[model samples]
Structures are given as structure tokens and as C-alpha cells.
Target chain A: MRRFVRQAAEILRGDPAADRVVPPTGITARLTLFTAAAMAFLAVFALALSLAAGRLADRWSEELARGATLRVSAPAGEMEQQLAAALRVLETTPGVTEVQPLTDDEQRALLEPWFGPDLPLESLPVPRLITFQETGGGYDPDGLRLRLQAEVPGAVLDDHRRWRRPLLAAASGLRVMGWSALALIFGALGAMVSLAANASLAANAQVISVLRLVGATDDYIAAAFVRRFTLRAVAGAALGTAVGLAAVALMPDTGDTGGVLTGLGFRGLHWLWPLLVPLLAGAVAFLATRIATTSVLGDLP
Target chain B: MDLVITFDNVAYSYGGGELLTGVSLDIAPGSFHFLTGPSGAGKTTFLRLCYAALQPTAGEVRLFDRPAQELGRDGIAAIRQRIGVVHQDCRFLDHLSVADNVALPLTVAGRDGPAARRDLDDLLGWVGLSKRADARPPELSGGERQRAALARAVIVSPDAILADEPTGNVDWEMSQRLLQLLVEFNRMGRAVIVATHDLGLVRVAKKQVPARVLRIANRQVTAAGADL
Candidate 1:
């Protein structure tokens, strides 16, 4: 640990002579910084996407799993009797906490987005929906369906298994894709850093020769390059992360839209996640530069 | 005196052509020798072998009693610290100041401090480069660059100094001054090997110090008499 601290200090307080040995390549420096910043920006969005997808999937699965809907359809005169019978069966069902039939106004509000605000409920033979909340393990749909068929023949129990399965699956898949995007961003950052380092080493071949001729060890020479690139990556990533966070913050609030597009953001402690982007970028640059410089120096002399 | 470097029946080849063959020599502490040869001769190759820059294609070369091939990367670097080399091009980090270039060896060795600064100032003063300490390598004259190279070479006070064509790009006055500085190092008990095509500088060196002149020809080394 002490040795590590000393080495860190050495990298922080670099040897001015060693750094001066390698002439700066302006294009390569700018390219590395720009690439790091761009990658960090993308990485922030990817992380937010993954976290949001995870939240969405969990909420959909849990909420849909715990509650169910019962729809009763019959002749217009018999519909009232069938819905009352269906509600009685649901209220007596095990694990069913609250059973309430949807009021005409509530049903109209649900249809307003598709049929405009003035939905003609009296003209259509609309099915009555009994929304039931559950507790503990929730009511068994098969058992509830058997009881409803025996009592209210027109009632159908929808456990939401069909739509819920596909919706949860899609959310989970989206989460995986978001995480994969993050991985791809890191991979691209590594490749860019490696190319930049290799270019710098090639351009400064004479400087390397001079350093080797003067008895400078390979590690000493490599440290100069690694320190420069790592610091640049860190700085660039920091700036990008700040901008990305601001952009995410300025996005339409999820509460206003209540849609998936607006939900691409962090919640609570999740905001701390983007802070790791710059650190990870710095580490990638450090490893890439170290490997490239050491490999090239080893090939010399 | 201890033997600083030894080449035993060593040979080197480049692109399937042998440049040095059956060459055997030993450099002793405080010894002064001059290597003179025609163009295309292997004087630089021999100096490179002495510093472990190039391994022998056949036989063996040892530095400070350790076989060259047996030394690891760090070992070679450590050995190089004890053997200073000057190139014909007088290569310097052009971006660095003359003082920084001269103090390169110390900085590489992690010995840079107030003491190193004082020593560097004294050495630059000795080479008459103290006034141009802040000047960059490209800004210095050929003579100034050569002096800076020499100062850099001897700053570490290595056991041996190998200079390849040190006076190749300088005037006669500058060559004489460089030779005088080399002779001074010889007097201070450091083995010095100078590779040059300048017989006049070789003769002057012999007059000032008991120096051996070896000439490389026909891919082999042989002693040359004073008449040559």
C-alpha cells in the first residue's frame, strides 16, 4: 500500500524532464479527449436507460401479478344481476382484499383517450369490469374462474397472465439491451484510447530512443504517457458527465407524461451512479496506455 | 583496474551480412582508447556492443562481469547508468533546455534534487554552457550541442564513456576543446572509448594521455602505429 501511494505520488508529480522528452502531438491529444468525453456522455444515457427499465419491469410485474380484473357480459337486462353475483363471488374468494365494480364515470374516463371525452356508454352493450385487489398470495385464478362459472355464467377471470408475461419480458429485454449498450460504450472508449496512445508512441519514437539511451527504464518512460492520457480521460469524462446529467435533468418529468420516454432518468440514490463514468474512463485509459507503451518499448533495444 | 566490459570472439550480423567478426577486447577502468576506422567500418557497432545495446550473434559479451544476455531489462538499465554513451548525432530532447538535457541521466535514476542541481550547474560551468543553460538543443550551436552531450555523458560519473564521432560536426577549435574535456575525464580515472575518423584528434589525444588507437578494417580490429 505504501509503495502504491508512492507510485501514485510519482504519477501525480511527474518528472518534467521525462515528460519533455516526448513532444506533444496536438491532434492525438485532442482526439483522445474528445473521444473520452463523447463515450462518457453515451455511457450516462445507457446507465440511466438500464436503471429505468429495471424499475419499469419490476413495477409492471409486481402490480400486475398482485391484482386481477373480472369482466361480466350478458343481455342488457341481465348484466346488472351478473355483475352483482360476480362481485359477491370475488368478495368471498380467499386472498381477495377489495372488490369494487367500475362506475360508469370511471369506465368512461378510461375510454376517453380513445373515444373522446363524450363516450356513449348507454348506447353500447359494454361489459362490466370488477376490479379486485389482492393480499397475501392473491386469489387463485383457476379456483375463482370455477366458482364464477358456477354462479355467474357470463363472468370471465383475467389474471392478466397473457399481457403481463409479454410486457414483463419486453421490459427485462430492454434492461439487458441498455446494459449491453453501456458495455459497448466502454469497449469503444478502450479502443480509441489504445489507438491514440499507439499513435503518440509512434510519433515520439525518437524521444523514446533518447530516453532509453539515457538509461531511463521502460516503466519510467511509460508512466509519463499513462499519466497524461489518464488525466485527460478523467477531465474529459468529468465534463461530459456533468453535461449528460444536465440534459437528463432537463428532460420532461416522468410525473407529467407518465410515459416510458420521459422515464429515462435516475431516482434517489441512483443519481450517484453516473459519477463512476469518469473513474471508469480514467482506468480504461490508464490500462490501455500502459499496455501499449510497455509493448512498444519492449520491442525496442 | 577492474574490467568494465569484455567482448570474447563476438560477431554481429545485419540483414544476413556479418559486420563484426572474431572481435575480442576488454575495457579496463581508467583506460583511454580511440577507435578509428574508414566509413562503413563497425566502430559504432562495437560501441553499441560494449553498452549492451546489441547482443552478439555468436560468442559472448559481458558488462561489469555479467553476461549481456543474462541481464534483465532493469539490469541492462542499471548497467547503462554505469556506462555513458555519446552518439555522433548528439541526440538531445529538442524540447528540453540544455540543463534538463544534461541532467537527464540523474533524472532517469531518480537522483534529481538540490545536490544534483548543484552538480549540474558545476558541470555546465565546466563545459562553458552555464550561460546557455536555458537554451534548447536546436537553439544551441553545433559546438554547444556537443558540449551539452559531453556534459550529459559525464554527469553520472560512469565507470566508462563511449563517444561515437563526438567531433564529427564541430570545427577544429571545438574538436580540441572536446578532446581536452575527454582527456580531463581520463585523468579522473574513468575509462573512455572514442570512435572517430579524425586521426589528427587521435594523435592529439595520444600526446596528452597514454591512449591506444585501434583501427577497424576488413571486419576486424587491429592496433595502428603512430605513423598511420
Candidate 2:
């Protein structure tokens, strides 16, 4: 431990620019900074997407699962009578919290995109619809179906299982893809850092050889490169994080606009999560440079 | 002082090309030996073996009575701390100042910085490079470079010093001064092995100190047994 400390101290003391904090010089510094900046920007998007997908999955699963739709497809004279009978039965049923019958305007609005602004509801054999919401203990699907069939022969109940299952599955898949993208980003960061370190090693071949000849071990030489790259990664990542967070914060969070793309930015503590990106980038740089340095220097005398 | 190196029937080759074979020798402590050979006679290779830089393909190289391969990198490095080497090319980090270059070995050995700062001035003075301490290696002359290499070699008061063509790039006066420094280290009970083809240097050292000459030929070490 004493020896390690001594070596660490010597590593810092050997380089005048060790902690001098001068403006970066050479192409490696510039390239490292640029890579870090671009990666951070991408990481922000990935983080936002992941968080949004997760929240979307939870919200869709919870809210959509608690509601069911009742469709009454009867002959021309009995459609309103069946829908009204089903609504009355649902309202009186146990665990049935609220029942709302869709207005003609609301039904037209739902069908406006596919049909038109002025839907011909009288000419078409469109089914009458009623939405049923449930409290904590939802109504039993089999029992409710039996009751609706007995009370209103043309009434059919949908617990939203078909639509909710697929939607939730898609949302969960989206969340997985988002996380996978983040993993790929980190892997790319490691690759870039390794490339930069190898280039620096090749450039400083003579310097490394001389230092080794003077009794510097491979660890000492590696520490120098590792420290330099790690610091660059850290500084660059911090700058990138700040810029990325600011960009994310500036995004408009307008409410849903009839299936329009919205809410692309971070919400709540999700913005703080991207702050760890720079730290992770620094760690990746540190490990990547260290591995490359040791491997390269190990091949040396 | 103790004899720190011994080679017995050591053979070494690179890329399947034999450079040294059937080499046997002993370096007594506090003794200075001059190695003179032709260009392809493996002088540098022999020096490398003595300093544990390379291991023999056959036979044995005992450094402090330990086989070369038995010592790990750290062990070799520790041994290197006590044995300074001066390369023929006199290489240095072009990015660092001369003082930093001279202080490199100390830093690698994990010496105290303040003590190195104090000793660094005296060391520069000894090599007559006090003024150029702040200059870079590329800015110095060949002679100054040799002196700096010498200063670096003896800075740790190593048990032994191995130099390959220490005066190859310098003038006669500088070569003589470098020789004088080696002699001084010898008087202070440090083993010195210098590999060079300079016949004049061998003759010059004959009058000042008792020195033995070794030659490499036909892949073997043979003592010349003569000062000149």
C-alpha cells in the first residue's frame, strides 16, 4: 500500500501538466472531448426514451386494465334499449365504480380519423358503446358476461384484455430497446477510449521505452495514460451532461394530442439519472485505457 | 560491495537469428571492465543480459544469485533500481526538461521529491550540466547528452553500472571526461561495465585504473587479458 501510494505520487509529480489544468492540446484531447459530448447528447435521448416508455407502460397497464367497454349490437329498434339495459346492470353490479355512455359526438370524434368529420351514423350499423370503470376489486368477467347476456341479449362485454395486453407488451418492449441502446452507447464509449489510448501509446512509444528503461514499471506507465484519459473523459462528460440536461429541460411537455408524439423529455428524477452518464463514461474510459495500456506495455521489454 | 552478475554458457537469439552463444563471464564488485567488439558482436545484447533486460535462451544468467527468468517484472525492476544503464542512443522523453529526465530514475524508485530536488542540483553540477538542467534532451549536444546519461546512471549510487557505447556520439575530450567519471564511480566501489569499440579509450584508461578488456567474436566471450 505504501509503495502504491508512492508510485501514484510519483506519477503525478513526473508530469508538469499533471494537475496543471491547462487547455487541452493535441488531437487526442480534442477528439476525446468531441466524442464525449456527442455521446452525452445521445445518452440524454436514450434516458428520456427509457423513462417515458417505463411510465407509459405502467400508466397504460394500470388505467386501461381497470376499464372495460360494453358494445350493444342489436337490430335497429333495440340498440338503445340494449345499451341502456347493459348500463343499468353495470351500474348496479358489485365492484362497478362508474358507467358512462358515449355521446354521439364523442363516438363521431373517435371515428373521425377513419370515417370522416361527419360520420353517417344512421346509415351504418354501428354498435352503441358504454364504458365501464371499476374500483380496486374489479367485476368478475364471467359473472358480468352472464348477467349482461341474461339481462340484455345483444350486449357484449370487453374487459380491455385484448387491447391492454398488446399495448402493455409493446410499451415494455420499447423500454427494453431503450435500455439496450444505452448499453450500446456505453460500449461505444469504451471502444472510442480504447482507440484513443492505443493511438496515444503508439505516439509516445519512445517516451514509454525511456521511462521503462529508467526503472518505471508497466503499472507506472499505464497509470499515466489511464489518468490522463480518465480525466479527459470526466471533464468532457461533465460538459456534455450539462448541455444535454439543459436541452432535455427545454423540451415542451404538451399533453397528448390524439396519438400525436409528445412528452419526449425527462420528468421528475429522470433528469438526475442522466447525471450518472458522465461518471459511467469516465469509468469506461478508465477501464478501457488501462486494459489497452497494460496489454501494449506488456508486450514491451 | 559484491559481485552482482555472472554469465555461464548463455545463448541468446532474436527472430531465430543467433546473436550471442557460448558466452561465459563474471563481473566482480567494484571492478570496471571495457567490452570492445565489432559492430555485430552483440555488445548491447550482452549488456542487456547483465541488467536482466533479456534472458538467455540456454545456460544461466545469475543476477545477485537469482536466475533471470525467476525474477518477475517487479523483481527485475527492483534489481534495475540498483543497476543503472546508459543506452548507446542516449534516449530521453523529448517532452520533459533535462532536470526531469535526470530525476526520472529517482521518481521511478519512489524517492522523496524534496531530496531529489536538492540532490538534482548537485548531480547537474557534477556533470557540468547545471545551466542546461532546464533544457530538453534534444537541445543538448552529443557530449552533453552522454554526461547526462552518466549522471542518470550513478544518481542512485547503484551497485553496478552498465553502459553501451557511452561515448559513441561525443568528442575525445568529452569521452575522456566520461571515462574519468566512470573511474570515479569505480573508486567509490561500484562495478562498471562499458561496451564500446573505441580502442583509444581502452589505452587511455590503462594509465589511470586497473581495467580488463572483453571481446565478443564468433558468438563467444573471450578476455583480451591486455589493457590495450
Candidate 3:
């Protein structure tokens, strides 16, 4: 780690004489900078998506795992008795907490979208919903079901397992996809930078021969090419990351209801991750140019 | 320690044919020598061997008392710093200004400080290129380019200077001026070897300095018995 930091510091310390050896304008210069910027721009979006998916996965797993609903359906005579018995059984349960039966107004508001608001609640039979929380370890759904079968025949426990499984799987898949996209973006960044470096080295082969004849060491010649490409990559990536963050910030956010599409951006401290893209781009450029020059110089007399 | 370069029965071959054979010589410190031969008489190849640019096909070429084939790439670079070479082509980076091009040796050696900068200025001025310091190599004429190459050669204060046709592109007056610069360097205790086809330049140099004349003939280097 210390050696790595030292190398980073050395790279940051500019070598103007060495850098001036290479020509100022070339196709590789524009190619490398453009590739790094494009890759970093795509990388920012992928990073935001992965983080959002991770948050969604954690929320679905934690919240849904600890809460359940009990629905009681029967004749009007037995419905009230069943709900009362279920609540009594839940209150005595070891892991269950915050047990409450929904009032008539609450049930009416929940059904108002499906059924008309003016429906007569007293004429027809409707089910009662008992909402309750659980401890961190959660209650056993099978044990609660057995108790409710014996005491309240009309009661059914919904541990949210049916609703949570697909949602959790979807969130996890999205997270994997987002991360895979990011990995591909970085891989593409490395490949494009290497291609540009190789082109630059080939174009400057005569210049390299001249420098070597002038008593320039392998390290000195490599520094001239490597430093130029690295600084260009860093500058380009910084611009790209800034534009990406701006684009993400401009995305339409519908608060909590927006789900996956709208809330696609850095939140809180996660904004700092994209800041490292330029540094990472510089690192990639340095490695690519170094490797390219080493191989080419080895072939030289 | 007294000899800058030595070739012990060295032979060099390329494409399965011998270009030079049975060559043996020693270059002492602060000596001036002129190499003269026919156009295809391997003068450039001989200079290349002195600087570790080519490994002799047989026998040994010792530079700074170390065998040329034994040194690594860095070792070769270190020896080159001690022996400055002015290529026949007058190669320059072309993109850099004349001043930066002349300071190429000091830049590569990591000695480009204020002292080196001042030396570069003085060296360029000595070569009559102080006015054209900002000009690139392509913009300079033939004589100017040769002068710039010489300035670059001596900018590092190299222990030895091996120039190939230093006055190949200049007039009689300019050639005399360049020869005087080389004679001055030889007086200051630096080994100098100038390879050329101009026997007149050789005759002119002998009057100014105790310059030895060598001729490469019959694939072997031999002394020219006061021929000029």
C-alpha cells in the first residue's frame, strides 16, 4: 500500500521535459480522452443503479420479513369472534409485537379504490385484517398457523413470503446486472486506452529511437508517453463524471413512489464514489502506456 | 582507466557476410583522431561499435573497461552519457525547439537544473545558435542543424565526442569554425573522433592539433603514415 501511494505521488509530480518529447497533437490523444470520458459517463449511471438496487433489496428483506397480516373471513357472527381470538393468540406469542385490528374506517379506505366509497358495509360479509410486527428473529409462521387453526378456524396468516420472494429476487437480479454493467464499462475502458496507447507508441517510434540515441533510458522514454496519456485520461474522465452527475441529478424523482426508474442517482455519501473515476482512469492509462512502451522499446536496438 | 574505448581483434558481420574483421585499437583520453576511408568502407559501423550500438561478431569491445555485450540496457545508457554521438543524419526530435533539443542529454540524465540551463545557453551561443534557439529543427538549414547537433553533443560535457561528418554540410569557413570548436574541446581534455571523407579537413586539423589520422581499408583499420 505504501509503495502504491508513492507511485501515485510520483505520477502526479509532472515531468515537463519528458512530456515535451512527444508531439502535442495526434489521433491517439483524442481517442484516449474520448474513450475514457465515455466509459466513465456510463460507469456513473451503472454505479448509481447498483446502489439503488442494493438499497431496495435491503428494504424488502428487512421490512417485509418482520411484518405480517392476519385476514379473518366467516359469517358476521363468527368473524368478530375469530379476529378477537387471533389477536389474543398473537399478543401471547413470543416474537409478535404491536398487534392491532383495523377499524371500519381503515378497511373502508383500503377498499375505496376497488369498491365504491358509498358501498353498504353492513349488508355484506367482509374479512377483518389484523396487522402486527415481529421481533428481529421473527415468529414461526407454521406455529402461528397451527394455533389459529385450533382456536380461530376462519383466521389465515400472511407472513408476506408470497409478496416478498419475487420482489427480493428481482431486486437482487437488478443489482447483479448493474454491477455487471459497471465491470464491463471498466473493462472496455482498459481495452480502449490500451489501443490508443499502442497507436501512439507506434506513431512515435522514430522519436523514441532519437531519444534512446540521446542517452535516454527506458524509464525516461516511457515517462514521456505515459505521463501525457494519463493526464489526458484524468482530465477527460473528470469532465465525463461531472456531466454524468448532472444528468443523474436532473432525472425526475417522484419521491418514495418512483421505485426503480426515477430514483437513479447518488444519495448522501455515495456521491463520493464517482469522484474516483478520474483517478482510476489515470491509473488505467498509465498501465496501458507503460506496457505498450516496454514491449516496443524491447524490440528496438 | 586511461583508455576510453578498446577493440581486441573485433569482427562485425551482418546478413551472413563480414563487413569488418581483425580490427584492434585503443582510444586514450583527450586524444583527437580522424577516420577517413571510401564511401562504403564501414566508417559509421566502426563508430557504432565504439558506442556499444552494435556488438562485434567475434572478440571483445570494452567500453569504460566493461565488455560491451555484458552490460545491460541501463549500462549501455550510462556509457552513452559519457560518450556523446553526433549522428550523420543530424537526428533531432523535430517537435522540440533547438534549445530543448540541445539540452536532450541533460534532460535525460536528470541534471536539468539552473547550472545545466546556463551551460545549455552558453553552448548554444558558442555554436552561434543563440538566435535560432526557439526555432525547430525542420526550420534550420544544413549548417545550422550540424552546429545544433554539435552543441547537443557537448552540452552534457561528455568525456568523449564521436562526430560523423561534422562539417559535411558547411562551407570552407564554417567547416574551419567547426574544426576549431572540436580542437578547443580536445585542448580541454576530451577525446574527439571525427569520421569524414574530406582529407582536406584532416590536413587542416593536423596543423591546429596533434590529430592522428586513421584509414579503414581491406576490412581493417590502420594508421595512415603521415599521408595528408
Candidate 4:
């Protein structure tokens, strides 16, 4: 423990403000800062995309899994009869709680987007709609479909499982893809930071050579660069994160009812997740700089 | 007494070009020696071996009874803290003041020992560089740079001091002052090895202090003639 504290204190001993004065300004600092900023920005998007995909999957799976839809298509004379039979079948079903048939106006409202508004539904061969609510133990969808086919030949049972399954599966795949994108972003950030650090080390070769000649160990020399780059990356990431979070906050809040894109921002407690990005980026920079500095110094006399 | 340094049949070649070959020597504790040689004779390379900075391509270099090449980074660091080195270039962190530059060894060592103003002032005064303590390396003359390097070397009170061409840029008076400081450190029981090409300085040094002059030629170190 004492050794750990001693090492930490040793690492923190140097004044970066003083030491950084000798490193010529402009290109190197710009490269490091720009890379940090770009990585952080991409990280923000990845986090949002992953969280959004997760929410999408949960919402679709929950809403559709517990509900089923009923469609009744019969002769104009038999439409009411078939809907009535389907509703009766659903009522006798073990888990069925509430079953309601759509009024003529409601059926016309459903098809208004595709057909004209002045459709005479009484004469036209339009299908009737009914929605069923299931209790704790839902009805067996195959049994219900068979009962409807025999009792009401024009009736169709849609448990919503088939559509919901594929949709939820796609959402889950999207979540994985989103997370994979985040992982790739992190890896890319590490690689870029490592390269920038290596370049910085190469640029400051004379500084290292002089330090070594004066009996500065590889650790002491590495600490200077590590401290410098780590702080820069942290500062840059903080800026990037603030901008990212602000952009997320400015997006339209599509609460539970709103469409997908409007709800792109973080939900409850998810705001805390993006805050870790800067810390992780800083840690990456710290490790990258240390590795680069030590490797270069190891090659020196 | 502990043997501070030993080189046995050490052959060092840089990428297959031999600089020093079949060299065997030992540096005893508290002994002062002048390593004199012509240009391209690997004087700096030899000094690097003393502190375990450059490993011998063959044979062994032992510092304080431990083989130099076997010393890991931490081990080499420990050995380095026991020795202070001055290069012919008299390098310094050009951004730092002379006082800060002088305090580098202590700072790097994590020593809580105070670098009192008086101590720095006195060391600077001894080297005739007290007035330039606030100056950066780039601001100082070549001789002043050499003196600052010397102050940094002795700041840690190391077991040994290794200087390569320490006085190459200074005049006779300044060189004599630098020699006196090394002689004083030797009196205080610090082993000293100075590599230089100046036979005149070596001759002048022989009068006030007993220093063995080792000459490097043909990839080996030979003692100077007795006539000196």
C-alpha cells in the first residue's frame, strides 16, 4: 500500500504546466485533442443508439406479448354474425378478460389512411376488427385460431407473436450491433490515442535523450508525457461529452407514446452512463502514453 | 571496500562495429581516475557502461557486485541513483532554471530532503555560477552549462561521479575549478571517472591530486607512461 501511494505521488510530482512549456506548440497538441474529441463524440452516439435499441426491444416485446388481435371477414350479411361468434369464442377462452368489436365507424377510421374517407362500409366487403385482452395465463394462440376457423370460417386470430417475435429479434440484434459499434469505437479511440502518444514521444526525442543523460529513469520521463496526454484527453472528452449530452437533451422527448426518433435521448438514470466516457477515455490515454513513452525510452541509451 | 564497478573482457560493438573489445577493468570505491583518449576511441561509450546505461555486447559489467546487463529497469534505476553523470554536451532541461536543473536528481529520486537556497547558492558559487542560477541552459555560456551539470551530478551525494569531457568547453581557470570540485568530492569518498582528450589538463591535475590516467587506444585501455 505504501509503495502504491509512493508511486502515485511520484507520478503526480511534476508540474505539467512547467514541463509542457518546452514541447513546441501547435501540431502535436492539435492532433491529440482532435482525436480525443472525435472519439468522445462517437462514443456518445453509440451509447444513445444502444440504449434506444434496448428500450425499443423492451417496449415492443412487452406490449405485443400480452395482447392478441382478432379480424372477421364475412359476407356483408354475415360480418356482424362472424364478429359476434369470434367475441363469444374469446369470452369463453380461459385467460380472456375483455373483448370488444370495432364499430363501423372505427373500421372505416382504420382504413381511412389507404382508402377514401367516403367509403360506404355497409355495402363494401370490409373486415371487422376486435381486440382481446389476456389475463395472467394467456390463451393458447393455436387453439384459439383453430376454434375461430371452425366456428367463424372468415375470422382470423393474430396473437401478435409472429410479428412481435421478428420485430423484437431485430431490435435485439440492433442492440447488439449498437453495443458492438461502441466497442469498436473504444478500440479505435485507444489505437488513435496510442498513435498520437507515439508521435508525441518521437517529437520529443531530444527532451527524452537529455533527461536520460541527467539520470532520469524511463518512468520519470514517461510520467511527464502520460500526465500531459491524459489531462488533455480528459479535458477534451469533457468538452465532447457536454456537447453530446446537450444535443441529446435538445432532441424531442417522445415519451412512451412518442415515435422512435423523438425518444432518442436518455431515459431515467441513463444520463449517468455517458459521464463514464470521459473517465474511460482518460484512462486509455494514460495507458497509451505510458506504453509509448516507455517503449521509446527503452530503445534509448 | 565495495567494488563500485568492474568490466571483465567486455566487448561492445554498435551494430557489429567494435568500439571497445577485450577490455577488463575495475573502479574501486572513492578512487579518482582520468580516462584519456583520442577522438573516436569510445570514451563516452565506456562511461555509459559504468552506470549500466549501455550493456556490453559480450562479457560482463558488474556494478556493486551485480552484473550490469542483469539489472532490470528498476535495478538500473537504483544503480543510477547511486551515480551522477555529466555529459560533454552538458545537457539540461532547457526550460528549467539552473537551480531547478541542479535539483533534478533529488526531484527524480523522490527525496524529501530540502533543496535549501543556501545549498544551491553555495554549490553554484563553488562552480563560479552562482550569479547564473536563475538562468536557463540556453541562456548560459558553455562553461556555465558544464558547471550546472557538475552541480546536478554532486547534488545527490552519489557513491560515484562519472563525467565525460566535463571541461571540453571551459578555459584553463574554469577547468581547474571543475577539477578541484571533483577532487573535493573524491576527498569526501566518492569515486570519480572523467573521460577527456586533454592531456594538458591531465598533466595539470596530476600535481594537486593523485589521479590514475588510463588511455583508450585500439579498443583497449592502457596506462599512461611513467614519465608523466
Number of the top candidate by TM-score? 3
lDDT of 3 by residue, B1-228 (tens): 568989999999999988899999989899999999998898999999999889999989998789999988988888889898988789998889999999998988889999999998899889999999999999998888988998888888888999998888889888898888899988999999999999999999999899988899878899987676
The interface root-mean-square deviations, each candidate in sequence, come to: 1.3, 4.1, 0.8, 3.0
Among all windows of ten consecutive residues in candidate 1 chain B, which has the lowest summed lDDT?
A: B219-228
TM-score of each model's chain B: 0.98, 0.96, 0.98, 0.95
Per-residue accuracy of model 2 over A39-143 as CA lDDT, tens digit each: 877887888788888888887888888988888899888887887788889988999877898988988999999999989888778998898788887778899
Clash list (residue pairs), candidate 1: none
lDDT of 4 by residue, B1-228 (tens): 779999999999997699999999889988889998898899999999998879999999999999998888778877877888998988777777888788776666655255455676777888788788888889998778888898988887889999999999989888988888889989998899999988888888888778898989999988888855
lDDT tens digits, residues A1-301, model 1? 5543454577677667666667778998999889999999999999989988898888888889877889999999999899889988988998997888999999999889999998889888999888888898766778888999899999988878897999999999989999999999988888899899999999889888888888888878888888888888888899889889999888877662454457989889999999999999988888788788879888987
lDDT of each: 0.89, 0.83, 0.87, 0.81
lDDT of 2 at B110: 68
DockQ values per model: 0.67, 0.43, 0.75, 0.48
lDDT of 3 at A195: 78
Worst 10 residues of 3 chain B by lDDT: B219-228
User: How many residue-pair clashes does candidate 4 contain?
Assistant: 0
Q: Per-residue CA lDDT of candidate 3, range A1-301, in tens?
A: 5544544465689877777888876677888788888988998899899988988888888889788999988898777777788899999888999998999888888899999797577777888899999987778889999999999888989999999999999999999999999878877887787778778878888888778777888877877777888898998899889999999989987766667667777778999999988988888877777777778888888
Off by over 4 Å in 1: A1-17, A75-85, A88-93, A111-125, A136-139, B226-228
TM-score (chain A) of candidate 3?
0.94
- lDDT, candidate 2, residue A153? 85
| Candidate 3 collision pairs | none
Q: Docking category for candidate 4?
A: acceptable
- Ten-residue region with minimum lDDT total, candidate 4 chain A: A16-25
Give the DockQ of candidate 1.
0.67
Judge candidate 2 at residue A183 and give its lDDT.
91
